[model samples]
Target: MALYGKLETEVEIKASAEKFHEILHQKLHHISNASSDKIKSCELHEGEWGKVGSILYFTYVHDGKVSVAKDLIEAVDEENNSFTWKVLEGDILEHYKSFRIRVKSIPKDEGSVIHFTLEYEKLHEGIPDSHSLLQLCADISKDIEAYLMGNNNEGSFIAKA
Candidate 1:
């Protein structure tokens, strides 16, 4: 088996694309409030919150386990409503030599469609693809959309931190 793998998933959201992008790129710290069960906390570790090359620390639940990740903001494209994050250190590093995630929200007629992509180089061929993680991304997207649309009771607290 190949050591490199990529996974992609998309979710249809009734929320505005710009608002969704702003939440992920600019106000990421508020994600914990929106998806309290999946993401425990997201905090800025170094540099600005939304700027490229900044570092962010995330404490989240995945596959029944609570894990921590330090990620670098690799790129942000406002025109495309997309951003890329490279994992610098985390539970993910244990299974993959390198991992990166890119997210983009495309505006549709009704609302928008959010896409998530995970690219990784595994330490070994035995390592499974990151399907579950991609699923988590989709779930989080739905949770955020619900919060943004005022359909979910989850907090929509956007932080300046």
Candidate 2:
């Protein structure tokens, strides 16, 4: 039987929900600058940015090693400030049969709560679950928030599983 799993994490951002959500959809490319430690670059590979079905290419560092991914913007829920990304090609595909990520930014009185979900099906039983990836997402969330708040935290925060 194939092994399937879901990993989730929540990060609190000290920025407004609407602003944070807008950055996620409108200024995705800037995310690399926001979380330089985790992501080396994020570029538009195909289609228009901020639109459904748009493709984004990412080069990132995870578990102290550099990796790359091609992700499809599968869905965008503006009303709820949610986005879904489907991984088409990448190092992650080497171990997982399929991988998908969903992120939702919920409004809060002070700021926003960023919720991340990673869903994957392992190619084999030997592949461990993606706890490191989930932690990277959480760290990146805080980095982006700091960037939006005019605080550049370059190299100050390190990600670990």
Candidate 3:
């Protein structure tokens, strides 16, 4: 028996959805260049980049601590510009029995709305809810949004709650 939860967040950015989606599909490992303050690096550990079931190893600075995760690319939808990754090993597993992250972007006339979704199952009844983790993700999405929009030095792009 498993208990699950899902969280979704979206932010508007002045970047092409198609281009950003393509970068995710083909060059996810390059994220450190654009967002070095958060992500230290990402590498393909198994299988090929942009391929379903491929494994990715990520080293990221989360809340001032370095955390590592090995994740599997679970799904990819090119037309919708979305992909999902299932966590294999990481700090997230310390509290969650299972975890996944999904990302996508929808185009708008003025800009694009980038979306990020998280799905997870608690390790046990005493483990507590995931509100903080979800909030962290939403914040990171805004950072990524700001970076991609060429607003690197501006704090104006932070999504308003």
Best by lDDT: 1
Model 2 regions lying over 4 Å from their true place: 153-161
Q: What is the per-residue lDDT of model 3 for residues 91-114, given as tens digits with 9 covering 90 to 100? A: 989989999889888989977888
Q: TM-score per candidate, in order?
A: 0.95, 0.91, 0.84
On residues 57-94, what C-alpha lDDT tens digit does candidate 2 reach at each position?
99999999999999999999999999999999999999
Prediction-by-prediction clash tally: 0, 0, 0
List the candidate 1 regions with Cα displacement exceeding 4 Å: 154-161
CA lDDT of each prediction against the hidden true structure:
0.92, 0.87, 0.78
Give Cα distance to truth, residue 85, candidate 2, Å: 0.3
| Candidate 3 global CA lDDT score | 0.78
For residue 151, model 2's alpha carbon misses the true position, in angstroms, by 0.9
Error of 2 at 52 (Å): 0.9
Model 2 error, position 86 (Å): 0.3
Look at candidate 2 and tell me the lDDT of residue 114: 95
